[model samples]
Target: MNRVDRLHSPFEQHSRALAWLAVFGLLLAATNLRGGLVVFAPLVLEIREALSLSASAFGMLTTLPLICFAVISILVPLMTRFFSSITLVVFGLLIISLGVVLRLVASYPVVILGTLLLGSAIALLNVLIPVLVKVFFPSRMGLMTGLYSIMLSLGAGMGLYLAVPMLEYFGHWHYPVMVWALLPLLTCLIWLPLLKLRGEVKPVTGARVTLWKSATAWAVTLYMGLQSFYFYAIVTWLPNILIESGLNPLEAGSTTAMISLASIPFNLFIPIFATKMHNQRSLVVLISLLSFSGLTGLWWAPQLAPMLWAALIGMGAGGALSLSLSFFILRTGDGVQATALSAMAQSLGYLLAATGPVTLALMHDISGHWLTALMLLMLLQIFQFAFGWKAAAAVQIKPDINTHSSKRTP
Candidate 1:
């Protein structure tokens, strides 16, 4: 088919119904990405106590899923090439559901293995959903992206907040972990109808959309990586940091829950505002400044009004993340470029991003303090600011041949 034919075909018949269905599916998939990761964060103390794990062992448990995320991200593009995005999504949900169920069995090895499986599933789904947004909801990319990001943050916040209560009600960690399985299972059922509808959709092909050579692409990827690094590191370690700062377990958990909850509004609002701007660099600077301020407040002035600082950090981080996803759709010329850039940015970006939590965990294990870890996170924000400035310049990624010819290089 010709270019116009390809563009018009996907929406020719069932556009409205299909768009709604795709949005629903995207929200469900996005919701699942952090269920496994955050649900366990609030339960870290219980796991450590029950398993009698050392500091290093506890750190390993937190870091393993991120490692899996990085590894699985590398494989997603190849997997999508052979399988339909719908098929990959369904398979990812299945794996995540199975992993959640397996966690109930609760051998140490089994728990770690389940975490890996969950991360792998999340990695695949994370990469595919943006491609779907680009393909189906081209007109409402910012709105849909914001909606999905809010759902993701809400799911994560709820997962962390509810875990202790769920365990308290059920009298065991197994049920708390197992309860999340129902989400993906329900998502899988809702998505089953799409299986029959798959082969009817045409496949993407040709020039590969070459995002690797683009400066805008690299800048966005680095920004994504840096922001993710800080977010995950803080999520994984903040409760412990609070505990070290003299709060009891319940108080620390509550603080972390509040931070996660605060992210929802910011995630929803940031992209909407960023999309309206002629260029996004000022917003990027604003977000980075907010995040740095929050982190500094948390480290230096723990005795001050901590929740306010925490909320500021949450808002900034959430905004940064939502904007990163928004840029994935906004910076591209077409669905093909969106797909390639999404795969490239998320795969390599997540690989780099995964290092933050692991590094924080290692520092906590070795130095027996959270100060060094917090400093490292502050340093990451510097990189985030630099790259985000370039990414928000409103420039598009064109071919190197055209770029060079236009520049008249010496």
Candidate 2:
């Protein structure tokens, strides 16, 4: 066929339109993934006071979602047998909307119940979105991953930034928390069109690959875990830390939002840059250094340079997360393997991350200082460096699978 004829082909036009639609759906969905977990942080003080929650109880608001991610992610791969990825994502968004509404109830137990629901729904979305990226943009994994990562980071920043203001405007914390439910509902509307294309983008099926046997997969898992630990720990407590350092609740919340927002640039570009490199070991080293310096500054003189510390931590954590998500695709040979690795890495990794908020809270309660927690967080950078170096190698995790029985993701 001539070039002009090929360009005018109906198949080519349809494919381009479908690609844009898929990308739009993915980006919108990404915005809902983290905002629910993050929006609660800035309003912690008001909620705790109203609910009479202890530190551990207050911590549950954030930790519950991570716990759900750890547990629910393992089952997502199996869910593919019954539902397409698009259906699962749409279901998750609806559930997330319900969870958000449930959380707005004035009762504490009801709040916890809502949080559990929300977390469970987010867990499903988390495991499958990358699978969608792998399925839809196999040749451009880095660019697509970066786009979604940026959306996640943007969601988090907006949640943190808007929560306090919403609280002020609504004259209550519940309303501020409840407002986030709209996002998932709106995203669900965006995603509904993809359901029609379900046959074209089914999930990986057949015999499951054993990613646990791969050392590189384990390294990626650990890298994901440590990076998550750092990010969640900061998200949960940074506002309180700033408060302790003499910032008012508003200032603390805004500063915390700054940390989440600062990561945007790294999230936008890191994956793209990493994909062009032979390996990402140097990037990992750079991540560790930035995090170390930020933590040190926070520990020593937070009041003097809170925004600077926030930016450094944001950049480090953002780059590390974008890279880790890329690793699920980069280190794996195909969609089936990417799904398996994502399941393993996120399940085990988030289980480890789930401990960060409560652990930091306990460390503070026991020592009556944030320094102990800060020290523990700083020490984690060393492990991040080690695992990231291993995970960043130009190595693909080759899982043993029965090719004849196994189904490739669309």
Candidate 3:
């Protein structure tokens, strides 16, 4: 029998079991991506107290992981080329687990290093996920993407809300960090079966396509990067911003947690709706309006029922994120393009996005306020709206079947 037939042969006897295993494995991997970031955010003060770090140092603590995430994302395609996606994903989880363990055992400098390792692992997993969806759930891209995104959001929220309580119960920050190690470790266990499934089948070979020449490709990358820029900026600094605006630290963290909770619904619903629509333009416009309105509310009247504004922003951001993941699948004609596009968009976009939090911090440091920073963010949203309009239109990246020559224009 041929290779494709051999791959399917095992499935004939255990297709149902393998299908459920793939779904569960994907969910577990998705849930671990943002846990490190969200867990660190709520515990920043405690970490600061323990390490005696300054504001700039605190900023570095947050920024280093993002920088690592961006830098490592650029290398994921290379990693995938040398190893199967399943192998890379399993390796990533192992790295993340080690990072968490290191965080518990190490000193301040070592903790920062551990964060870098964790970020790098998460970056690889992030790029691989959509490719896996394309491979295994070709017919259910939108639905599966939506489900994974929701799991990611919910996991992030859990990390934020549970960290402090866990620390309190355990009476040490180390326990909190150490406890999360179990997640990736568990994921590694669940994925062990799939690892054995990748026996030395001659590597499926293909010619590589250059994605930089495609306008649609660049547009999608910029949109993904800019949206991530704003999203991470908010995730890293929003609590501090809200606290500076008069809310206490607990209240600020709670508010940010609520925003994350609000995303759960939007992440689950948006992709399903986007798949039914011809183009995603209307959804883009609507979400942008909601996000802008929310930002305006936060800037102008944060004292007046800020939770409503937070929820609005969360809903819009969640929808945008889901749509971006959907575009990674929809804009590509097949798995190869999906892998390339996912790598390009996430690597370049994340590198660009790494500036957002630092820029916001610098603006605040110089101006002694967040108004100008918010205005800058609003301008980014405007650009996002413009690009989203172009990217949401139906178009596919057609690669030359013989040579893998590809271009995206329409």
lDDT of 1 by residue, 96-153 (tens): 9988876666477787777778878888888778767666655566677888898888
Positional deviation of residue 324's Cα in model 2 after best superposition, in angstroms: 0.8
Scored by lDDT, model 3 comes in at 0.77
Cα misplacement distance, residue 52 of candidate 1 (Å): 6.9
* Residue lDDT tens for model 3, 216-285: 8887888888888888787667888788889998788778766777887788878878777888899889
Model 1 C-alpha lDDT versus the unseen true structure: 0.75
**Model 2 alpha-carbon drift over 4 Å, by segment:** 1-15, 44-56, 172-174, 242-252, 402-404
TM-scores for every predicted model: 0.86, 0.89, 0.90
lDDT of 2: 0.83
State the lDDT at 5 in candidate 1.
Answer: 21
Q: For residues 1-410, write the lDDT of model 2, one tens digit per residue.
A: 01112222112434555567778888989988878877887788887888888877877787688888999998887887567878999999998989998877778899899899899998888888987787777666778899999998788777777888888988988776776788888888778877776766665566477877778999999999999989888877998999999889988767876776788888878888887889989889888999999999999998999989988998899999999998988897666677778888899889988888779999999999898899999999999899999999998887755532575562
Maximum-TM-score candidate:
3
RMSD of every prediction: 5.5, 3.8, 4.4
Candidate 3 steric clashes: 0
